[model samples]
Target: MLAAVALAFDMTSVLALMYPGRERVEILGQDGVTYVYACKPGPAGETPAAQAAKAQAAFEENATKFGEAFAAELMQGIEAGAPTLGMALDMTRKTDGWAGAITAHLEKTYGCALLG
Candidate 1:
């Protein structure tokens, strides 16, 4: 249920971020999920306010795209591995092994942090 909701939000973000005339983008994963964030390099004389606004727009756009793709990809993987991974995580949590392993897995694999 929670995963579904999160996935929806991510998808929505992606739609919102898909803007025209944007460039210089890269994607990354933090904990266990992939993400897309935008970065731009330009003239040095741009004012702070303008730079902030540009960065904010770019970041938001990148975030939206990243979230949508991440959710879609996650759903595909979860469909394939949920039964085993879910069980493992639950049992590991009960045994205090879930934290490090899960966090590390997400960080190394997806670059997304466990929200929680």
Candidate 2:
């Protein structure tokens, strides 16, 4: 029984190593905007360190795009001035509702479970 358990564990680890899936990284910008980036796994022949470096490069490249969009939106909002209480409440409600919609979209699009 012990041998069987060990073998099962070994098989699982080997499979994970063989097909180590893409990585998801979430970055919170200095301006309080959050971005999620997905990096594809490296080709089979690449060393683990090289794979990590590639992923990091991809992340940095993608972060520029995300940051620009977020900054533009934030600047637009700031230029619009403060909102009324009702407007604030309405915006809050809409953002809250969007959480569920975004989660569903991600699951449907990517076929992956989301952790809150």
Candidate 3:
């Protein structure tokens, strides 16, 4: 995704998207592979990443949630201030309630309200 139009969040070396012009956040977790949270308008208001993921089969074996076609777009759409891979190394470790913990961290740390 383009750096000027997206927000990236992550936990445990995993990166997630809260793309620009979209009303939802997709938070992938190492604990169970993926943890998604979408806001109002639901599917109709999905981000490019979310739409791309839905375009493919759910949980395609040996393939990413978003197939190869979306890889480049996703890569290019990241916001300029989005966290880098290096930051993940120093990010919070996995906990029992990883989803909640990471969500809290994202909102509190980045001031980006995932739920809003």
Candidate 4:
């Protein structure tokens, strides 16, 4: 199924991103799903602030595309069922809910009380 393929791809991508020196980070969403990723070290001579900025930039770049793709896949799954239009609309509203959950998890894990 497409969902299975997507999950497989996600797992493989996570594994491919991992390296010996990379930091292993696990973020548990309120939805009960856990996202695992390996954060790579910043480039040589880069300041901590610069590294954080770069990480944020990279996260935003990939998150948008991944979110869109996931939304489309979820819509496809809904369409395959006999859901009503109202149900579809409700589901669409939650397309970006995962982002909030992830952000919460990250903030809590990193002790970033000021994260928005």
User: lDDT score, residue 105, model 1?
Assistant: 47
lDDT of all predictions, in order shown? 0.44, 0.46, 0.40, 0.50
For all candidates, what are the clash counts? 15, 0, 6, 0
Ten-residue stretch with the least lDDT total in model 4: 107-116
Error of 4 at 61 (Å): 1.1
Residue 9 error, candidate 3, Å: 26
User: What would the TM-score be for candidate 4 when compared with the true structure?
Assistant: 0.37
Cα TM-score of candidate 3: 0.20
Better of 1 and 4 by lDDT: 4
Worst 10 residues of 2 by lDDT: 107-116
TM-score-based ranking: 2, 4, 1, 3
- How well is each residue in 1-116 modelled by candidate 1, as lDDT tens digits? 35544443455345325432223233333344433322222356544334334444444455566558656756775777767567556544543543465445443433333322
Greater-lDDT candidate between 2 and 3: 2
Give one digit per residue, the lDDT tens place, for model 2 in 29-88.
444644443434344555433444443444445546655855665566667864656555
Off by over 4 Å in 4: 1-41, 82-116
What TM-score would each prediction reach against the true structure? 0.35, 0.37, 0.20, 0.37
Candidate 1 Cα misplacement greater than 4 A, ranges: 1-44, 82-116
- Please give the distance, in angstroms, between residue 28's alpha carbon in candidate 2 and its true position after superposition: 18
Worst 10 residues of 1 by lDDT: 19-28
Candidates in descending lDDT order: 4, 2, 1, 3
Runs of candidate 3 with Cα error greater than 4 angstroms are: 1-22, 37-105, 114-116
Task: For model 2, name the residue pairs that clash.
Answer: none
RMSD of each: 14.4, 11.8, 17.9, 12.3
